[model samples]
Target chain A: MGGGGEVIDNKQVILKELVKGAPKESDMAVKTSSISLKVEEGSKGLVVKNLYLSVEPYVKLRMKKFEHPDFSSFTPGSAMDGFGVGKVVDSGHPEFQKGDLIWGIVGWEEYSVIKNPGSFFKIHHADVPLSYYRGILGMPGMTAWVGLHKVAAPKEGEYVYISGASGAVGQLTKLGFDDAFNYKEEKDLDAALKRCFPEGIDIYFENVGGKMLDAVLLNMRLNGRIAACGMSAEHNLEEPEGVQNLRIIIHKRIRMQGFVVFDYFPQYSEFLDDVLPKIREGKIVYLEHITEGLENAPAALAGSENVWKQVVSVSRE
Target chain B: MGGGGEVIDNKQVILKELVKGAPKESDMAVKTSSISLKVEEGSKGLVVKNLYLSVEPYVKLRMKKFEHPDFSSFTPGSAMDGFGVGKVVDSGHPEFQKGDLIWGIVGWEEYSVIKNPGSFFKIHHADVPLSYYRGILGMPGMTAWVGLHKVAAPKEGEYVYISGASGAVGQLTKLGFDDAFNYKEEKDLDAALKRCFPEGIDIYFENVGGKMLDAVLLNMRLNGRIAACGMSAEHNLEEPEGVQNLRIIIHKRIRMQGFVVFDYFPQYSEFLDDVLPKIREGKIVYLEHITEGLENAPAALAGSENVWKQVVSVSRE
Candidate 1:
């Protein structure tokens, strides 16, 4: 059925059970299974060998059982699904053929057979690292672009403050923002914001919520804009920390909006057109913390302090 | 330089000192003074006989020693300044004449000399109740219209929720909102919101913040909008209550904005053009709790349960 094709063993990181609070390595298990490198006849599907898998904070949310209509929880004993860069091994689909490089949502396994290949995006640029699709050139990059440009609508000379200034989203925000600070180092976030932005912040890219948000509210200038990108500080907590200074929203006339990356998927090509040149010009920089094996993916996803973007290299290629 | 020359005894409401928490009647004192119904020669000022004075919640904020640049605190032993309707007794300014009806920021006294008549709005419609200028046709009315139409931007069939649904801002919100309920009556605000908005709330006119806001955050629909008008609950509290469920904003893609009425002052004439007819046709109903005399003004401002728009009728027209 194929030219020099053979059966192979697939190594996958599976969710052992639903996690309650902060995810632990014990909640997941690495397993090995055998699969034929061939797509079934009369089926519109393609077999892919996953090269790199992304470990994002949002994936921890999917590890728990929740009634989210848009996202389903990872089933126990099944391989976790996440954003990944892959190579098409075999295809019965009209759009994709063998050896086509693609990136999108894929299983956290060495090889996966995707029934609906509609979600996949074909990789055209061979010069750029394929792993970039797992970080800066992928979802996180689009998130930062849409949030700052469309949502926050930042203007030059305006003061900007971003929490979690070393993360995937915050690093991207630093390129556009006037001044960026790492919230982790600050003893008092309010005092820190005051020192950085004495005139007050006009735009705030909210990544870490809780105390950071409370402090930012105190330093916001009139008609300030806050792009609520993520609440990583509250994600692991059983009860999210209370924000008390929300009344300042009225005093400052602030507009705070929360958005999802999926909503901006249609503008992906336009985003690429703008960002690719910036990348080539060295105007944009990306930092990634990569884990080599599927066995260590759970630790990578659980995250570490000072880590930028957590990425898992599923295969050597 | 007087039309009706007379030295009238002015009954004035003066602040005794700065208030700590919820205002008491004793915090303000009623004092009597004399003012000539005449404007000094060469001075660009006018003398007015106060008819009605508005008792708004924001007046309480000015009672304390807060350093608000735009609005100064009520100085001890001095007459409080607030929105009121009056008839011009004498004028030195080119725009004003004797017997002209006007409304704007005026002293909480029977008769006073207004140095700057520039901020005042002339009452063109003699048919409408002059007291309406202090409440519905004035500040509170503008607040509701701008918050709903401009901020929330509600569409037809979209669910709307309003906390403190019996106050000045809340009553006006009822006319435009599909359904309304008082936050005071509900033992569990989240359950009440669930009962009222089974499909989930699309727009929330936040009047009472703190715990009520926490509850509303739970019941918000995807892409929901929250018009943060006032935080009455937190105004009197020593330490404002904390809101814990803000992470729901990210999950639901919600937009929460806070604005001041002064920003929308330019649109006042446009607002009157739309709302005046609704009042004439009896399509809109307004409730006013009128408290007679400057002696009772402090009690009225302290706020009473089941009261809508509190107005101090200083002089019977």
Candidate 2:
């Protein structure tokens, strides 16, 4: 192990170029570089040794060249940043100290110097798998919880429909969903939704947007609630598909709302308190496709897979 | 006048055929039918002389032949029913008496036997124009108030954008809006919205959907609220235009909700209590294009005129 401020080799995954329509593995390359394992003095920075990196579709959105205040595009010739589990190697902040386990935004590299440690959440409970922080107990899980409990606010026995039911957030929401089917397998999405929900959907956890959203709009019951978490289907396209059934919103008195997981960061501790016990008691089921090593991250993210989560293990503690 | 159950000629606006794309004057015809100007014995019904009939865009939606539980399409070759101000000539209902001014769903004929008098709201305050019962004090007005105050729940000084800003409900909402522009005048809707709302819109009263909705989606601020009151622009078209910018809902964390006025019927008296005073004090602005006689009713509803409310005066007194 390197001494306090000694420079060491840092293996990083670099975004080679801005992605256009769809992200390709060729757009990212693994590069080795030397970095001083030191937090800048007087700066509230933490030198984190990234252990598990979450591969999310939103990262691909950041890979695109765009100018918007909401999302800052990832810079070319730099390591792509995303949600990850990390150990603090060095800390310049009072709250965090060396060897503290945390989860937040981190670079796709062996080591990342988080300048603003305020965004990071300290790992309070470790009874569950540490990798769970990157999936079920982290951003995606928090998203599902917030979208369901806070946004959609479904009543008991209400018909709940979920698109992208194979993803991280979708899988964790098994308790609420009555019927599940692969949207890809259906030749007619509207017909499939009708078949699944004969009475029409009361609560729709919207993850896959575009055509799915269009079909769901037609099937939504009166005063139905749609919590739009993500639009994974349209994110990769240069020109997103137009939704044709928006008029149904008025006809059915639907409440379609969109939300981001980061907005519910204040309730993370509350979420952890509620979900941790459920997970430990075998009440909650979480699945992940964990790929070992940083080299596989590009393939894992770029390749289409029917997995709950695509997590890349950089360095297992 | 006939003493009791004498048969009277009822001049009616009958939907000649189910309208396909756009409603033409030819689709509706003025017909006369003889009806008893008396309620049946031991029935909770009121024989009403229809005074003012409101020409609404939703009535056009009902012109189409389709089966949906939410809305009942107007039966072809029958007297079309909509919001109207009427006076009770004969009453079998205990709550209602002769000469009581009322506003409710009434047939587009001179005299209507309202079977469901429970749906009707008695007009207690008549200091303001009785035609206001067909507009500013009626369904569309209730819709606007509910959408803005109840659904969107905008804060003071929040950027409020209203499309179809010259309609019945739209004209009545002059109190809240700061910027007003005709959507038809703008060459590019997105640019127009951007020019008007440089800071981006916070509350959007969505009356015109389709392309206007697409443009508004791009110009919405973070955590914006969209109150879907009506979609007048897309109602006439056989194929409604697809909204392409719905992803902005997720990016901006927007809440777009749809509501029908009937859903808030419980709040009708409350709405009237609030708005009636404002109208009496000349605080609320209401404009209407009143076309006299049942023969001109079809033309008024069909013609594209820049007016707040299109009301047919069936019987002034």
Candidate 3:
């Protein structure tokens, strides 16, 4: 075996305990452990060196214990798993080989042995920044696409409103949406929405729930559609805020639907084909707030204020 | 012209003033006025002898002044207009002939000349009680059909929950839905829902809204659908109650849609074709709370409690 086959020191961001309310930096611990940098014989796993880890708002939902069977909570004293860009160091799987760059659900560590590498998408376009796989070219990007085009099915000249218009999902939504607003800056969300859309919102790309959703409901036009992508505003709350104006949904004949991105994976290639050219031509703008080391990831993920997009860089190409 | 064409005393229920909150009997006054039972010479209208007037919760929305353009309030001293079954006494419109039975928007009066008879639907099936045209075979019936089958799209063996399950709309829903419960009797709605549907609700026919909607949201299964038919509970309130569990919509991947029966009018004949046979086979049970005479209509409409379907019987056939 080559010298590169030697055991390496792996740094991982471990969940110290199940989080309560908003996550804190203390809820996570950075641990260093030794790992063999070689794939075991007869194994169908890919040993990947994680290059970039996406810090997503939905990951917060996985930190708490809940009876929801669809989502599994992050195990205490183990590396947290999320969407990340990685390079395969060793592989026993047919689809992936050594040095193949891929992106999918991966551990928040320097290196991880992904047993089921079927979820991972091999990166074909290396011309763009590899980190783009974590944000604009990853699951979040596809979520914005499917939610807007498939669920909402917005028509031309229709008023579209997007909450969390500065966050990761929101930023991606801005590419397709005609009008966008940062909900945090608005004093009266209903008034602001009314000003932006005098007639009323025809389509609302909902990322933040609670007061934002309540306000959106009041301003919806007749036959308005709401594509609920995420509820970041209600995720950390012990008791989520009450939405009062839901009755407006009846008056306006609105259709509100919630969807997860996992269902839209089959359209990933189609999305890439449509988006890659626009990104290359500078028609689409992508931003990332990168934290340099694994040790700083906890603070960056838990309490990064006013950031456009949060990502943790564990290793370089 | 026949002797019946002579000017006759029309008993009309006039709105004294715009109603606030829950309507009261005092808000309306029964007045007698002279009117010719004949349409104008060249105008397209019909002179109708009102048989049965339907009392609906949405008619309350018209009692208050709102900027909503789709509906207009009843004039302070004019007869209130609502859905009713009538016999055409005279007609200038080609669609109607003398003595033709019909159902549509009509005044809360014994005899009146309708300027716009365009909205009327001809009653072909006379074997069923004409009063059934106001409840089980009319707008409320269509509401239940469109809401359950078209919007909610319930599958066989799917758990269906209907709020306001004892009301007119709910009664019609029970004809299609296997499991139905009156939310008023259940002290703990969540517990009641859990007992009714241990696996969680797949379809919810929303009628009451407010607190009931909040409770239903918590028990919705993944990919659940809610057809918002009415919000009678919130219609009377000055300030509608806030719904706290809307975030569950995201977790459960729910679709909630609000619809009006007017949009489903084109499918009326189609709906009747499907529902008429069921009624003839004694498979569908119809209930009516008949309030005799135009004088007692106000108290009957505004104060009738525990009544399944409230109908103002204006004239005998």
Candidate 4:
């Protein structure tokens, strides 16, 4: 081993067991263990101190056992892993060196040793807040960009309705959508959508599925497009709600497409180039609710229903 | 009006009233009416002798009162109009002339005056059976063509499933698609789809929606595409059955699109050019159930459940 260093205490938020329905704080535990800080000679491994951990709605889906390749379940007694920002403590990887800031999949812990750092992207723009990697410049931001620009392909002046407008990705909907709504506040989603879009919705950025999807289907215009981003409403439910108004899609000639942000990882550089300048110029505003320390990650994730982006800060530097 | 020759007695199938649920033979009445076979000068009108009228499943939708621009309700006490083959007896339009074979919207009557023949397409290829205009060369054919070739756009060897395989458009599904099934024969749609597509369905031609759509949603593969062609099961029901498996669309990254054949009307000539030779070479086999006379049109339309393509012959020649 090249950079063999003294062992240090590492605390990780571990999943006690596979969760069903709504996840509770008792489902996870913060355990501390000693770890050697070193990188094997020829193995392109990276030792990173996790700076911030992102709490996303999809994490709830992963908490339950799923056969889907996209939403693989977390192993019991293992540290929960998701998109996070980290600083390289030690590296054997050619692309990454010590002290380099990177963002990708990382464990919810004080430090994570990545066997393969190929998937990680180097944080080039350091002038902006490093926490932006967890919210605005990271997975959630790319989701809104890809779903709106690529999947929906909305036109100028078209009426766009975004469901779950208070989530991390949903908040970023302010980038291009004509109208955004907090679906929780509406007594009748169909009525609210009708009032916002008098003619009808041309594009629907769907984050909250179930009853919201049914309502959007009823209010869609002719040849409307829908981007099926996520279903936060159905995430915690064992049995999701039924959608009734799909027949309207036939009458209106609507197109609904589903996509994952990871599918567009190759275009992350392009996304960064396009969005970084916008962020710097104050065109896009990012709101984050940061919870300090790795011990608090479990509660932050469980109670992040109203928060736009719940980012747990593991270290200040 | 040079061709104002004869005032002939025309037998017409008139709609008694707007129908709900399943239509009945009693909903229509065969009445005799007089009409002069003439086109007014400088009016760009034409006098057509109806040869054959197509009995499509969508005609049932028109029987009910709907506010949708596409599926307009049929007027009470008026001759029901639909796609048909006709011979231009008299013409003032530049495109159509006397005795020219044409196919377009025509009433369920022997002879009629068309004030706007601009929508009519002149049949240049008279070599094919004229009845083909009511089946393969008509609206149903175009529906299958546009939905498959243009909308779904399935690739080679992809697992394709077609519901309602006995309908007019579904019969034409033999042109493309890896597998086909009559939803009527299948008891458990989910098991049937699993038996047909073990891995998963890449593209689904959704003709019979309702529960069939729910089952197909579960069997859809990652990045699957669905062409929402029709929902015969829901069309009859006053309240449609809610689709429960729409959340699967988000997990599978499925794209479902709805389309109308009229949107592709401008491309009909292109469709004829593509499909004409395939029919001439006997590559495509068309099955038609011919009902003689306009008086039986109502019965043929009402009881066309088992029939592939029901063509009501107003006049053989």
Per-residue accuracy of model 1 over A183-214 as CA lDDT, tens digit each = 66778888988888899989888887888899
Scored on chain A only, each candidate's TM-score is 0.89, 0.93, 0.91, 0.92
For model 3, the superposed segments whose C-alpha errors exceed 4 Å read A1-5, A18-27, A60-69, A173-180, A231-234, A306-308, B1-5, B19-27, B59-69, B176-179, B231-234, B306-308
Q: Tally clashes: model 4.
A: 0
TM-score of chain A of 4: 0.92
Best by lDDT: 2
Give a tens-digit lDDT track for model 2, residues A1-317.
33357889999999998988668999999999988798766778889999999887778778887655556888999999988999999998999999999999899999998989998999978777777898889888888888888899989889888777777667577665567788788999999999999998999888777899999988888889999875243454467788888878886899989988888899998888888888888888777778999989899888846344888999988
lDDT of 3 at A71: 63
User: What does each candidate score in C-alpha RMSD?
Assistant: 3.0, 2.7, 3.1, 2.5
* Tens digit of per-residue lDDT, candidate 3, span A162-208: 76667655656556655656666889988888888888889988877
lDDT of 3 by residue, B109-141 (tens): 998678888888999999999998977898878
How high is the CA lDDT of each candidate model?
0.81, 0.83, 0.81, 0.82
Q: What is the lDDT of candidate 1?
A: 0.81
> What DockQ does candidate 1 have relative to the true complex?
0.67
TM-score of structure candidate 4? 0.94
Model 1 residue pairs with clashes = none
User: What are the candidates' individual DockQ scores?
Assistant: 0.67, 0.72, 0.66, 0.74
Q: Runs in model 4 with CA error above 4 Å?
A: A1-4, A40-42, A65-67, A175-180, A231-233, A306-308, B1-4, B175-180, B230-234, B306-308
The pairs that clash in candidate 2 are none
If both were scored by DockQ, which would come out higher, candidate 3 or candidate 4?
A: 4
